[model samples]
Target: MTKAKRTAKKLHHIDRAMSETAAAERQSGPMRVLAAVNELSDQPPLIALSAATLAAGLVLRRPALTRGGARMLASHLLATAIKTAVKRSVDRTRPHSVDDGYDYRLEKGGSRSHHYSSFPSGHTAGAVAVARAAARTWPAHAPAAAVSATAVGAMQLPIGKHYAGDVIAGALIGYAAEAAVGAIEAAVLPAMTRRSAS
Candidate 1:
């Protein structure tokens, strides 16, 4: 075969191998489980859970649950907004979509296309944000909440949704969102209390 033809044939074989590897990974039982668990972090379910917690708190007359639910919902929403902004600003292909796991494209801005918006993992951001809010309300569960958040972030890797760096950035965004919400509450709640007292 000519040099060009030989090169083409070799490239085809390499692509086939990569495709097989990717398919196998996707079919793994553990990965399937992870993918299912990741769905819990999705917006709809998270929102529903938050609303349920708040409603339960109201009905049971429990201040802690009321505060926890409010904070969880607010922080997750903030985190989602922050991640969406970041995804638009920084473009990177999802790991599963690219041949090279480490390859990423950075540009001035990104499109709304899901394929190119992978700089930060949205699922991880929301998960960590909700976890942080829960931990703040129930300080005793802080450790477990942190671990759960980390697990959610880590699961994004093997499932081919995001890279480690993406998860880390997402976690930071989550933390920032929660901190901002907490700060706002700290500043406003005391004033409201004083006003009510008067």
Candidate 2:
């Protein structure tokens, strides 16, 4: 065989190996807890809690809590918005949908979240955003925050919600949101404080 043909054969074998590994992980009984963890890390419950915190902070006149709540909500929104747009454009199908022992396809109309929007794990993004914000606010507990974020990421693989690349991309978006929001706060908060004081 020619060199190009040999290289293509090897690449095809590697792709099959990776797909098989991902499928086996989802079926492993020993790692079933990952499914539960994935469910817990979902966006709805977390967002509801954040909303409650925001309401409580406002009612109790707690500025710091209010700010934290606002930031948390903003981070969730940012991650979701980006995730949705990218999923719509990329149109990548879920692994379970694609694992037919065949090829992959990028379909149109990626509005169906459970099926099509699998490129970036929204759950992972939300978890990382919350963890990152907590880490930034309490620098001393950054290690624990990191562990929490990593655990959220770990659940995605065995749960079969996303590929490793998807998780990494989601994490990038999550961390970027944290950095962006922090910069905005650093620049705007001082100005707002000064005006209030005056």
Candidate 3:
């Protein structure tokens, strides 16, 4: 077998093993507690809270922060598009479908057919992408944004929807996307702004 195929097979095996381990630990009180915490991280209000914070920063006319917020938003959307395309292309089965023993407590109703296609998580990718963008725009807030992004990423763990490796891959993708956006913004936006000013 080719090296790429071997690596794919290895990842599949590792994913299966991790799924089984998560299933084994599903009912442990600590696991339950952690799952609860992860769930709370994305509570409706908290999910919207980030936007509100960014909006407030913009309203206050904080140039650096407003720019950061805008950049983060743009990068996150771009990352989501890329992540979704890749997920569709790979079409790997989600952990839940692979192992019925996994937790289903917090599974969303009417979730799209995720039976196949669980490579990189859109949530993780978007969160990390925005976080990286935010870091570039506002270095002071980057650490906080990263912590928030991590919490968003952790939400996937308890449901056994994705392996830790998947989240890591998504984060890397997000970071790369953020970097690309920054480069484009640096190259294009300033020239446009200068023209508009003149």
Candidate 4:
């Protein structure tokens, strides 16, 4: 190769090496911190928050708060269940594990192994579900809730926990779960109210 071409090739390799090193450092520092905070979106804490809101609503005798809590709980549960089912049925390798060629299998004996279960992000699903549920109840806070939920989903990208498509799918699943839960509540609550008044 010509001298100019050799120089350009060396520079490209050097830049790639620097980028890899930087990525390693980031994962050890800010990325780790972010991932840790992201764990708050997990099922246990979310479920606890829902139950606490429910208990507070009951103790304070507030029907709106009670309904909000119930909606949040139901939405999160449904989202999680849907996410789990999708993970089991559609397998996709995580971003970090893509070095060994991308492995994607849909509806073909997909396993729940962490590396292979990266299709629909569970964290994003739960966060979006809770956010949607809260927004449905308090329309004034919808913007803030949406931003928070989007942040949770976006964080998964940098942390190498999910692909963009996975996050998008997760958000859709979460929204649908909340919508379904809301419809069910709408149809049943009035009938139950009528019965109680009888």
Candidate 5:
């Protein structure tokens, strides 16, 4: 084989090895717990609780959380859209689709589609976005928000929906989104307020 062909073959072997390693990791007991937690993170009741907390902060006019809630919500939504687009483009397979040899305790009532792309977890992205925004808006609450984000992220491991790398990528995306939104708000909102006051 030519030198270029040899290099290509080597790369292919590396790819296969990486896939096998990932499969093994997913079958681990701790990973299964992470997957279960990830499924719980998507529960409707938990989501509702988060929404209610945001609403309560706004209704009560808690300066720390009112603006943070609005901005975080916007950033999280934007991150979700971006994540969805990237997942579609890359089309990474979830752990459950890799093989029938691996057992998956899938959450009941969850969508049956095995094709759900798992490049970046939407739940982790949203949670991280909200946590970052909250931390920035209320420095005093940063520790709590950080803890919540970490807990939510840890839950994604065992359910076999996403790998450790997926959660980390999702978190980075969310934090970037939150920062971008915060920058825009800082730059634009004051100007709009001043213009309206004139």
Candidate 6:
């Protein structure tokens, strides 16, 4: 290689090393905070939030808000169902469980089995579903909600709960579930309202 080409290659390696080092530091600092937020992706906390939203909608007499709450809950349900089926059918093991590139397990008995549920993360899927529903209901806060959802899904990596591919799969499933819900609402709600008006 020419002298100038050699210098350029050296600079590229140096820049790559710096970026990796900076990433490590960031993960140890602010990224650790994300761990706490990731816990909210769990079912209990999500259900609590849904219950509160539902109660507020009912007490305030906002049909749209109530429907939003219902949609959030339903989206989560849809994500859960899809993740469960996908996990079973895929039958892939978690990253932490693999060894010698030969790790494998099949989900047996039913949905409760943990043997092969790690290919796509269920928690990440539910988190994204809730966020998507919220975004549809409140357009103003879409950016913040989307960031939160992405963080929750990506957290599965540091937690060793899922592979990167699993996280992507979960997010896609969540998005699709919300889209399905939106389509159904668009088709059915207008007809219901028109019938009620008559």
Query: Could you tell me every candidate's TM-score relative to the true structure?
Result: 0.83, 0.80, 0.75, 0.82, 0.69, 0.75
lDDT of each: 0.82, 0.73, 0.69, 0.82, 0.68, 0.74
Per-residue lDDT of 32-90 in model 1, one digit per residue for the tens? 88789889987788778878888889999999999999999999899999998899898
lDDT of 5 by residue, 1-198 (tens): 999989976864564344445556676787766666565545343445446657978789885556766776777777777777666555555655655443432222233344446667777887888788778878998999898888776665545556565677788888888889999999998999899999
Mark the 10 consecutive residues where model 2 has the least summed lDDT: 101-110
In model 1, which regions exceed 4 Å deviation?
1-24, 99-104
Worst 10 residues of 1 by lDDT: 15-24
lDDT of 5: 0.68
Q: What is the Cα-based lDDT of residue 98 in candidate 5?
A: 55
Give per-residue CA lDDT, model 6, range 52-115, as digits (tens). 7877899999987898888888888898899877876776565444422435543342444454
Better of 4 and 6 by TM-score: 4
In model 1, the clashing pairs are none
| Backbone clash tally (model 1) | 0
- lDDT-sorted candidate list, best first: 4, 1, 6, 2, 3, 5
Those runs of model 4 whose alpha carbons end farther than 4 Å from true positions after fitting are 1-28, 99-107
Tell me which of candidates 5 and 6 scores higher on TM-score.
Answer: 6
Write the number of the candidate with greater lDDT, choosing between 2 and 3. Answer: 2
TM-score of decoy 5 = 0.69
C-alpha lDDT of residue 29 in model 4 = 80
Error of 2 at 123 (Å): 1.2
- Candidate 4: residue 113 lDDT (0-100): 72
> Which 10-residue span in candidate 3 carries the lowest summed lDDT?
102-111
Candidate 4 clashing pairs?
none
Candidate 2 lDDT over residue span 17-65, tens digit each: 4644765667667567667657777789768766776787899999766
